[model samples]
Target chain A: MLELIVISTLNGVLFGMLLFLLSSGLTVIFSMMGVLNFAHASFYMLGAFFGFQLTKWIGFWPALVLAPLLVGAIGMAVERYGLRNTHKHGHVAELLLTFGLAFAIEEIVSMIWGKSPLDYRVPALLDFPAFTIFSTNYPAYKIFMLAISVVIFVALLLVLKRTRVGLIVQAALTHPHMVGHLGHNVGRVFMVVFGVGSALAGLAGVIAGPALVTQSDMAASLGPILFVVIVFGGLGSLPGAFIASLVIGLVQTFAVALDGSLASAFGPLDPSTGPSVLTDIWNVTIAQVAPIVPYMLLVLILIVRPMGLMGTRES
Target chain B: MRKLTLAIAVIAPMLGHAASAEDTIKIGYIDPLSGGGASVGEGGLKTFQYLADELNAKGGILGHKIEIVPLDNKTNPQESLVQAQKAIDAGVHYITQGNGSSVGAALSDFVTKNNTRNPGKEVLYFNYAAVDPSLTNEKCSYWHFRWDASSDIKMEALTNYMKDTASIKKVYLINQDYSFGQSVRTDARKMLGAKRPDIQIVGDELHPLLKVTDFSPYIAKIKASGADSVVTGNWGQDFALLLKAAADAGLKVNWYTYYAGGAGGPTAIKQTGLDQQVFQITEGFANSGNKAAMDYEKAFRAKVNLSLWYPRAVNEMRMFKAAAEKANSIDPVKVAAALEDLKFEVLDGGTGIMRKDDHQFLQPIYISSFGKLTESEPFDEESTGWGWHLVSRIDTPQAMVSTTCKMTRP
Candidate 1:
C-alpha cells in the first residue's frame, strides 16, 4: 500500500511539473495580455515535431537549443500578425482567433510531418535508469524532465523578483497605467512575456514528446486537460496553478494507484442477494474510475473553495 | 534554341498519345491523407500507387493505362462523402477506401444511393479495413467488396483462443468507447457466454478514443477485479500507451488485443518488454510469407519512403489489382463482378477468395508470439527483433468461419 502511494505520488509530481511548465507560460500571458492563448498547446506540438526533425538532422542537444527557439519565433509571428489584429475585438475575439490558429496549426502539422506518431526516442545520454523505487526502475529521461521543469520554475521566480525586465513586466501586469507613465514599453513587455510563455510550452513539448507520444493530435489531447488545470488553479495565479496542477495530477495518479471497487467500500453485497443494479455493477475496478477524479475535484473545488488555493479571486 | 524546339516537337505527339491512353480507365483511391488515420491511409495509397505503376509498366490493363485519382478524406465521414463525390465527378469507375468502419458505412451508403441514381455508372467500392459485420451482413451492397474480417469473426477467433486457455477464469473487457469497441465488446460477451460460461466477466471499461493519457486506473481496476486476463480491441497509439502503462503498473496477466499486431505491434512489444507474453491475435497481412506480401511491402516502402506496417492497406491494394485483372477491363460493373468471383492466391500465401455470398474476402489469419531476436543470416536486415518472430499460422479454415449469404455469382 505504501509502495503504491509512493510510486503514484512520484509519478504525479513528475507529471505535475510538466503541466506547470506548460501552464506557467499560459498563466503569465493571461495575466499580462488578459487573452487566453488557445494555441499554446499547438506550439508545444510544434516543439515536439520540430525537436524530432532537429534531433534526426543534428542531434538531441542541438534540437534542445533550436526547437523551442523556432516555436518562440512562430509564437511571436502569431502575436504580431494574428493576435494583435484581433486584440481590438475584445477577449472573446482573441480567444476565437487563437482557436482558429490551433485548428490551422494542427492541419499544417499534419501536412508537413504526416499524421503519425514520430519515433522520437529519448537521447542516449539520458536513456539509463535514474533510480529504483519499490523495485521498479524509473528512467533517467523522466528525472531530466522533472529537473528542467524545476529549474525553469525557479528561474522564472528569480526573474520576476530580481531582474529589471521582469520587474517592469510585473509592474505592467499589476499596474499597467503606472508602468506606461514610467516610460516602459508595455507592448514590448507583453510580446516578450507571450514569447517566453510560448517558448516554455515548446520546451515542455520537446521534453515530454519522447516520453509521451509525439503526434499531430498530441496538442489537442492535452489542451482540454491544461484548461481544466488553469481554471482549477485560478485565472492568473501561478502558485494556484502550480497547486491545482499537482492536485489534479495526484488525484488521477493516486486514483489509478489505489486498487478497490466502490462496492468494497460499502461492504461486500452478494450479487445474487442484492438488487439487479448492484449485481450488474459487481467487480467494478478503481482504474476504471480514475479519469473521473479531475472532474470530481473541479466540481468539489468550485463548490468549497471558489477562489482555489493561493488564488486571489474567483474565476 | 533549335534543339529546344525539336525537343518540344518530339514530345508533343508523345504527350497527345499519352493523354489519349490516360482517358480510357480511371480508378479512384480515396483514403485519409491528413488526419489521425493518415499513417494507414497513406500506406494504402502507396500500395495502390505501386499496383498502378506495376499494372502500367506491364503494358497497362487491357491496352489502357490505369489513371488513379487520389483523394484525401482526412478521416472525416463527411469529408469522405465529398471526396467520393469528387472521384465520381472525375469519372473514376472504381473507388476503394474504408479506413475506419464509420467512414466505410457512410461511404457505402453514399455509393449505394449513387448507384440507384445512376444505374449505368455504378462505382465499385472496395473496403480495405472497416471490420464492422453490418457492412457484409445487414448492409451488404452489390457494389461493395469487404476485404477484411468483421469484428464478430475476429471475436470468435479471440474467444475460441480464450476458451482453449481455460486458465483464464476472470476477464476484464476494455476498449475505446466507439462503434468498433461496442461491436467487439458485444460480440465478445456473446461468444464468451456461449463458449466458456464458467469464465466470469469481472469488469468492462470504455475510454474515449485518443483521449486516455494515463491508464494506471484502468489497470488497477483490472487487478482488483482479479481478472486472469484482459481483452481489448484498441488500435494505434492508444493500445500501445495502455499496454505500456498496464505493464509498468505490474498488471501481469494475459492481454488479448485484436488490432495490436499490425502497425503498433512493434512499439507495444518494445514499450512493455512483453517478448515472452503469449497469445496475441494480429490481423492477416505481412506475417504470411508470400510473394504479394513481400513485393507489396518492398514496393510500398520504396515509393512512400516509410515502413509498410499496416498490412490490411497492402492487402486492399492487392485485392484491387486481382479484381482489375479478373475483370480484364476497368469497367466498374465488370470489376465488381470480378471481385465477387475472385479466388486468386494473395501475396500473404492466403487464398484471398471473395465469396459471392457476401463479398467478404476469406483471407488467412496468423496467430504469432513475441520470440527472442536471433542474429540469423539470410533474413532481411530491415526485418529484425521480435517483429520477425515466427508462430503457427492459423490457415483460412481455422481463422474464419463460413458465412451465410446467398447472392448471385458473377
Candidate 2:
C-alpha cells in the first residue's frame, strides 16, 4: 500500500508536470492574444519532427535548442501569412484557418516522415536510473524532464510578470489602439507573443518526443487533453493550468491504481449476460476507466466552476 | 432499384464474358487505408499487392490476371460495410481485411447476409490478422475464412510454454479493453489457472484501446503487485508505450505478448534495452531460419520497405490461388468449397490447414524473443539490429482448440 501510494503520487506528479509543459503555450496564446491557436498542437508536432530531424543531423542537446526556434519561426510565419489573412474575417475564420493549417501540417509531415514512428530516443548521457523508490528505478531522463518543466514554468512566470516586453505585450492585448498610438507595433507584439507561445510548445515537443512516440499523428493524440488542461485550469490562467495539470494527472494515475468497482457493492456481473450499459458501468473497475476520469473532471469542473478552477473569464 | 437489378442481371453475363477475356481476379483490400490505423493498413495493402504481382508473374492465378482493389475503410466497421458494398458493386468476388476484429466480424456478417440474399454474387472474407477467438467460435461465418491463429489458441500455447517454465511465479495481465483484448485476458487467466495452478495472478488491467498515451501509472501498479511477468495483447502504440513506461521506471519483467514483433515493436524493445525479455507468440516472423521464408522476407522488404507482418497474408493469398486452381473456377461458391479443409504449405515451410469446421487456419505457432541477433539470425526488424530468436514452436495439434462453429453452407 505504501509503495502504491508513493509510486502513484510520483508518477502522477511527473505526468502532471509533463501535461503543464504541453499546455503552457496553449494557455499563453489563449490568454495573451485572445485567439485560440487551433494549430498550436500542430506546431508541437512540427517541434517533435524538427527535433528528431535536427537530432539526427546535430545532436539531441543541440536539437533541443534549435528545434523550438525552428518551430517558433514556422509559427511566426503562419501567424503572419495564414492567421493574419483570416483575422479580419473574425475570430471564427482565424480559428478555422488554424484548423485547416493543422490538417495541412499533418499531411506535410506525413509526406516527409512517412506514417511510421521515428526512432527518437533519450540521450545516452541521461539514460541511467536516477533513483529507486520501492524497487522502481526512475530514469534520470524523467528527472531531467521534470527539471526542464519547472525551469520553463518559473522562467515564463518571471518574464510575463516582470519584464518590459511582457508589459508591452500585456498592454497590447486589451489596449491595442493605445499601444499602437504609443507606437508599440501591436501587430508585431501579437506576432512575437504568438511565436514565443509556439516556441514553448515546440520545446515541449522536443522533450516529449523522446519520452512519447514521435510520429506524424503525435499532435492528434495529445491535442484534446491539452484543451482539457487549459479549460480546467481556468482557460487563461497559467497557475490554473499548472494546478489543473497536476490534479488531472494525479486523478488519472490514482484512478488506474484503484481496482475497486461497484461489483464489490453490487455482486459480480455475469459475462454470459453479454455487453450492456448497466453491466459495463457496474463491472468496470476504476483502473479500466482511467482515461475517462479526466473528461469526467472536465464536465464536473465546468458545472461547478464554470470559469474554471482558476480563471478571470466565466466562459 | 428492381429495374436496375434486372438490368444488371442482363448485362452481368456480357460483363462476365468480357471480363473472362481480360478481366482481372479482383480481391478488394479493405481496411484502414487512411487515419490512425493507416500505417498498418497501408502495409497490408503492399503485402497483398506484392503477392498478387508474384502470382501474376507466374502465369497468374489460373490464367486470370490478379488485381487488388484498395478500399479505405478508415478502420470503422460501418465504413468497412460501405467499402464492401462498393467492392461488390464493382464486381469484386473476394475481399480481405485484418486490422480490427470488429471490422472483420462486421465484414463476415455482411458477406454472409449478402451471400444469402444475393446468391450469385457471393463475397468471401479472407481474414489475415484479426485474432479474436469469437470470430471462429459462435460468431464464425461460412463466407469468412481466418488465416491467423485465434487469441485463445495463442494463449493456450503461451500458457503451455509457461507451464513448463517455473521462473514465472506471478503474472500480470494488461490488454486493450476490447473484444480482442478481453478474449486474450480471459484465455490467459483460464489457461494459466488450468496449466500452471501454482502461478498467482497479481494484477489484471484493461485500459481503453489506443487511448492511453502514458502508462507510468500502470507500471506503478504492476510494480506494487511484484509481478515477474506480464501477458498482454496490446499492439501498435499501446505495446510501444507500455514498453516505454516500463523502461522509464526500470521495471524488469518478462513481456509475453501477442505482437511484440509488430511495426515499431522491435525498436521499442531494443530502445528499452530489454534484450530477449520480450516474447511474442505468432504464426511466423522474419528470421525463422527457414531459407525460403528468409529469402522471401529479404526480397519483400527490399521491394516494399516493410517487414512481412503477416505470413498469414501470404498463406491467405497463396491458398486463394491454389484453391481457385483446384476448383477450376473463380466463383465464390466453388472457391469457398475448395478452400474448406485445404491444407497448403505455409510461407514459413510448414503445412497450415484451413479447417472446414470454422475456417480457422491451424498452423505451427512460434514463440520468439526480440533481442541481439546471433550469426544465424540474419533478419533484424525495423533496422533495430536485434532480430527475433526462436524460443519454441508449438505444432498445430498442441495449439489447436475446439470450435463451436456450426457453419450454414449454401
Give the TM-score comparing model 1 with the true structure, all chains together: 0.83
Note the DockQ of each predicted structure.
0.28, 0.82
- Supply candidate 2's per-residue lDDT for A137: 84
Tens-place lDDT per residue, model 1, A9-76, is: 78788768777877877877786678789998998999899899999999998899899988888888
Best by TM-score: 2
> Which of the numbered candidates is closest to the native, going by highest lDDT?
2
Off by over 4 Å in 1: A1-14, A53-70, A73-112, A123-140, A143-166, A250-315, B1-23, B159-172, B192-203, B222-229, B250-255, B261-265, B276-287, B310-329, B370-386, B402-410
lDDT of 1 by residue, B104-150 (tens): 88988898889888978888887877888888877777778877777
**Model 2 spans > 4 angstroms off:** A266-277, B1-21
TM-score list, all predictions: 0.83, 0.96
User: What's every prediction's RMSD, in angstroms?
Assistant: 5.3, 5.0
In terms of TM-score, how similar is model 2 to the real structure?
Answer: 0.96
Q: What is residue A98's positional error in candidate 2, in angstroms?
A: 1.1
